[model samples]
Target chain A: MIEVKNLVKTYGDKRAVAGISFKANDGEILGFLGPNGAGKSTTMNILTGYLSSTSGEAYINGHDILEDPIAAKREIGYLPEFPPLYLDMTVKEYLYFVYELRGCRLPRNTHLKEICELVKIDNVYNRRINNLSKGYKQRVGLAQALVGNPNVLILDEPTVGLDPKQIIEIRTLIKKLGKNHTVILSSHILSEVQAVCDRIVVINQGKIVADDTADNLSRELTADHKLIARIDGPKDEVIKLVQTIPGVVSIVADMQRERGVWEYNIEAVEGTDIRRELNRRLMSRNWYILGLRSSELSLEDIFLKLTMGESVNEFLADKADDLEERYKEEE
Target chain B: MNAILKREIRAYFDSLIGYIYITAFFAGSGILFSVSSLQYGSTDMSGMYSGLFYILLVLIPILTMRTLSEEKRQKTDQLLLTAPISLTSLVLGKFVAAMLIYSIGVCMTIVYATVVSFFGAVSWLTVFGNVVGLLLLGAAYIAVGMLISSLTENQVIAAIGGFAAMLVLYLISAIATIIPVDWIARIFTELSFAERYSPFTYGVFDFSNVLFFISATVIFLFLTIRVLERRRWS
Candidate 1:
């Protein structure tokens, strides 16, 4: 387990990490989501005792990283953004060196055998690290971190430059590792974090904006009900009819998907379900209701909304206005 | 500390830098022995070690250039510093590893001493004094190079800086002669490592000179540790 309290890292005039704090519980996968240069790496570095924070405390298993680094570091296995590997050494040599360097009390042969198997790097164990592919090099880096079997793993952008197949492989490995070790993974890739992390902490400009589960974050950020309806009716008449319905906040007609069919996105009052009433109204008006469905903000939308600090309704309004302006130009 | 020492030693041999350094060092010492003792047909090895002193001006840089600089350039310091070992032990581990390699190279010069003894009577005490002096002086030089290496990530800069620093220390006695004042000249001469080491080459193992070499090595090693600690703050 790890805990950071009001951690601040300032580089002279600029602050790289400005008073941010979060925790990764035991056997949990905590994703640090942020754009590039959002202090994610800085936070990870401070946690791993690689870089000192300007102020505040980071504790690993009740030991402060600064005051008691050796004890604190003993509980951590860190893989920096650029894996710290000696390319001249082979994979087995590098991991063995790390094993001895961390002062592992376990039998070296059995311990290394297990790590090589867990990260599935046995095939490249004899090859020089620099001679391997980037994916294999990353696996060796992961193997280095697992040498001592530390309780916590701090991985900074573990899948930054890997190919799609390698990314999925590494993600699967991390998910498997999460069954025992507490993991704090940082990345700018949204879907990667959404796929593997149990809890998400969104950081922006050295500040934590939102901290919740993936589902909880999107659900909490969504404040209004949304519905998409496909109806065979005149566009203007449909818009006017939807506006007349109570609890309907706004309606925008989407581009026609089929001949004589109009799609409209409807925003209703919070906690309101106007789909049934609207469907009945459209049917009574002799408009064929081809499709109707309820919708909510996606994780991508929630991330952009919270980080950009823009209201969803305002964004949609601007988008609709832009579409209408283009239509007028085309006319 | 042991892990770092083993790895550095293994790295040196694996990458062929150890063999190159040892071969280069012995070649330099062989050239010096041929000129100083063999051609002259003298059994005294003091002059040969004196010649070795100059060879060390270049060899020490090569020996220590990659000790810390390569770690920085390759970003391996992140792994080392984040491990459970203390920084003092890390720096000391590197210092001892360099010393061990340098000692092995210096020990090979004993064969020259053995060859000299076959021709005539060679003073074992004189050989002992020069060996001690060489080790002490070489340790100080390695420490200087290690400190310089910690200042930059580029091995070239570290090597050149280390050579320049060693050259200045080697020439301190000569530079002292050009001083205008008596007191200043005396201070420069006292500060000259060459002045301290000259007595040992004459087969005199002065305790003060031994202390001088040791304290210089310790000071520089301490400086290297301070540089490492300061890096974390900056």
Candidate 2:
């Protein structure tokens, strides 16, 4: 278990992580969601006892980070933003060094073999760390963290640059580890977190805006929300007609796809689903309904909402390009 | 602590740094030894001991430049610092590793002393005292160099800084002659290493000199521990 209380971190004049607090239960995989520079890494650094908190305190399994650093550190395994590696040494040598540094008492011969099999990096054990691929390097780093069988594993952006297959493998690995150890993973990829994490904490501007299970936060944030779309007739005419409807508050013609086809996001006044009525109206006008899709508030949309959807184009309607562009701008 | 010490020792031999470091020290000391003991046919073994002191200035940096600086550069300190070990253990481990390199190199030079004793009349007790003093002096300088290595992440800066520091210690011995030997200056001059080491070269055992070298080594090592410990807190 981990407890963070009133944590605040200031870099120079700018406040990076404002006073924020949260806790992760034992044997739970808690996901920390945020855009770039949202104090996710800074919070992980402090929790791992790598950096000192400016005002608050963090306890790892009841050991205060500052007071009992060695004991606290003994229970925690950390993989920072950059994987700490010694390029000159082979993977086997590096892991042995970390194992020894952690003061592991297990007989080295058997313990290292068990760990190698657990992380599944046995084939590349003899290869120099500098020669391994990026995905392999990440695994070596994870293997190092698992050296002492630490109770709490604090990983920051674990699956950032891995390919899709590698990402799934790592996520599966984390899920398996979560059953025995308390894990805290920070990532911008929502589906990845939603797929594996037991609980989720959404932070923005160094503050926890929403903290709950993935499903509960998704359901609560988008209560009674429905997206209505009518395909056919002129989009402007559709907008004008929707305005006459009793519940419709605003109609926006957002896209003009080749020729006469047009689309708009029409929001109703009070979280009402007007898709049935709107579809009937368009059918009566002799307009053919091409397609209409409602945007479900997945963990991705909730992540954007909690982070303050300032630049996320609502008209794009789940377009990944806009999300990627927004992710870059935040960095 | 033993793990880190073993790893550091392995790195020296694995990467050829241990070989290079020892080779350079032996090679440099060999040339000087051949000139003083063999070619000159000098019966004075203590004079050869004086020449060996200069090797400390050059070789100490080679043995210690990468001790902490390379760890920071490669981000390997992340592994060591986060481990359950204390900072004192880490610093002490590296200090012992560097001293091992110095000890190995100095041991090989023993063959020279053996050759000289067979050929000439030399005070074996004085030579033994000189070797002990040399080890103490090398240890004190290694402490200073290791501390400087921990302060910076750049290996080049660490190496140059270590070299410059050793240079200052070397100059401490001659500083009194250039400056006046006055009452105030006299105190600083007496604390210099050369003044302290002079008694041993004359075949006299001085408790004060031995105490001075031991004190210097302990103080610098304490400072090294302090600097590393402070890096963790704030």
The per-model lDDT (C-alpha) reads 0.88, 0.79
| Model 2: how far residue B194 lies from native, Å | 4.1
**Candidate 1 Cα outliers beyond 4 Å, as residue runs:** A221-304, A307-312, A319-331
Index of the highest-lDDT prediction:
1
User: Per-residue lDDT for A1-331 in model 2, tens only?
Assistant: 9999999988777777899899998999999988788899989988987667788999999999889989999999989888899888899888888888888877886888887887778999999999998888888888888887899999988887688998888899999999999999998766777888989888877888789998886566653434535466786577677778778655656566656666665666446777778777777887766767664565555666666555534543345345445644765
Report fnat for all candidates as fractions from 0 to 1: 0.85, 0.64
| Candidate 1 clashing pairs, residues 3+ apart or interchain | none
Query: Which CAPRI category fits model 2?
Result: medium
**lDDT measured at residue B166 in model 1 versus the true structure, 0 to 100:** 94
B1-234, model 2: which lDDT tens digit per residue? 899899889888887879988888788778877777678887566666677677777778777888998887887777777777777898889989989888887776567777777877767787778777778778887887898888888878888999988777667656756676476567767677666766676677788888888888788888877876666545
Q: What is the TM-score of chain A alone in each candidate?
A: 0.77, 0.79
